[model samples]
Target: MKLKRDFYLQDCVKVARDLLGKVFVHETKEGIAKGIIVETEAYNGAIDKASHSYKYKRTKRTEIQFGLGGYAYVYFIYGMHFNINIVTGIEGEPQGVLIRGIQPTYGIDLMKERRKTDNLINLTNGPAKLCQAMGITKEQYGMDLCNSNLYIEEGISIEDKDVDITKRINIDYAAEDKDRLWRFSIKDNPFVSIKVKS
Candidate 1:
């Protein structure tokens, strides 16, 4: 079943952790690409220095983040790759969960072709990589995940023992907020973007 808007209306941290093992599907003109979510990172609005909407700072690029939950907040980074984020929280709240990694389950050839590689791990092991592999782009921004071609679906249940929490990656500029354990991943999942250090 596709997740409803209500599923993303709660705390972003909760939504991030719960997203594990769910199937993220993107239907494009090329084909349908689907994968099991393996990693995610929650960014709380205003309070989270690492968040784009921190301090309630609004900009053209961040407008979608302030919209109602269950919307896509896709953005381009490094002047090339697009990062796909699921908008969470109430309207004007500006919270989001970044989908970091996925294990491809369908359209493997399509994903490999899009990513220009056949190696499974290199296909969708990171946010930008997953976006490319799934054919997601800025055009998808503000697209409602509750009723869209790109949406999450019910998949395998992940137990507590399978979850690993850690600080978000590549946001050192956030200072103290960088240490918060907001990143969640499926423990021992080969598809997870980064291996957690013991």
Candidate 2:
């Protein structure tokens, strides 16, 4: 079933922790693509130096980040890739969590069509790649995951023992914040770009 608004209304930390076992699904005109959410990174709003919306600074690009919870906050990075994040926390709060990886559960052919390659291992292994496979883009920004075309769903249950936590990768710039250990993922999930010890 599609996850509800309340599912994402909680704080980023709780949302990040609970997201490990959920399934993220994208239904497109081409086909249906799905993945069990195997990894995620949280960015606390304002107070967090790691958050782009830190200090609640609103830009044309970040306006949606300040909207009600359950909205998508997709943005382009490196002038080439799109990173998908779900806006979390209460209204006016800009916290979000990046969905870093997923284990593909459907539409392999469709993923291949979009990616134009045959290497299944390379298909949805990272954030940008997964967004491409699922047809997510800036047009999808601010979409309500609870009722939009793109939404998260309940999937295979994972035991608490099977989930792991660690500091998020690629943000050593956050210094002491780098050690917050806010990243969460399923242990040994094949789609995860990084391996984690449980």
Candidate 3:
């Protein structure tokens, strides 16, 4: 079943952890592709220094975050790749979960073709890599996952014991927020970009 807005309306940390093992699907004219979410990181935009909308600072790129939850907060990072985040919390309060990794589950041929690689482990193993393999782009920014071509649905249930919580990656400038153990990943998942980082 496709996850409802209620799933995203909860605490971002909880949503990040709960998102493990869910099937994220994107349907396009090219075809439908699916992946099992293996890693995620949560950012509380209100006070979290790591958040783009830190202190609720809204810019052209961050304004979408201030809207209701269950929307895609796709952004271009480092001027090269796109990273997709699932907005969380209420209409006014901005929060989001970054999808760090996914295990390709459908349309393998397409993923391989887009990534220009046949190595299964290399495809959709990182945030930007997954977006490329799944055909997600800046056009998907602010797309509501509740009723859009891109949305997460039910998948294999992941137990708490099977998940590992660790600090987020590549955000050393977030000060104390960088140490927060908000990154959740399915334990021993080969498709995960990185393992638990202590």
TM-score of each: 0.98, 0.95, 0.98
For candidate 2, report its TM-score: 0.95
Best by TM-score: 3
Worst 10 residues of 1 by lDDT: 189-198
* Residue pairs with backbone atoms closer than 3 Å in model 3 (clashes): none
Error of 2 at 112 (Å): 1.5
Q: Is candidate 1 or candidate 2 better by lDDT?
A: 1
Off by over 4 Å in 3: none
Show where candidate 1 strays beyond 4 Å: none
Over 63-167, each residue of candidate 1 has an lDDT whose tens digit, in order, gives 988988999999999899999999998988989999999999999999999999989888999999999999998889889998889999999999988899999
Superior candidate under TM-score, 1 versus 3: 3
lDDT of 3 by residue, 1-198 (tens): 999989999889999999999999999998888999999999999989999999989999998888888999999999999999999999889999999999999998998888899999999989999999999999999999989999999999999899999999999999999999999999999999987676
lDDT per prediction?
Answer: 0.93, 0.86, 0.94
Cα lDDT for residue 124, candidate 3: 91
Clashes of each: 0, 1, 0
Is candidate 2 or 3 superior in TM-score? Answer: 3
For model 3, the run of ten residues with the poorest summed lDDT:
189-198
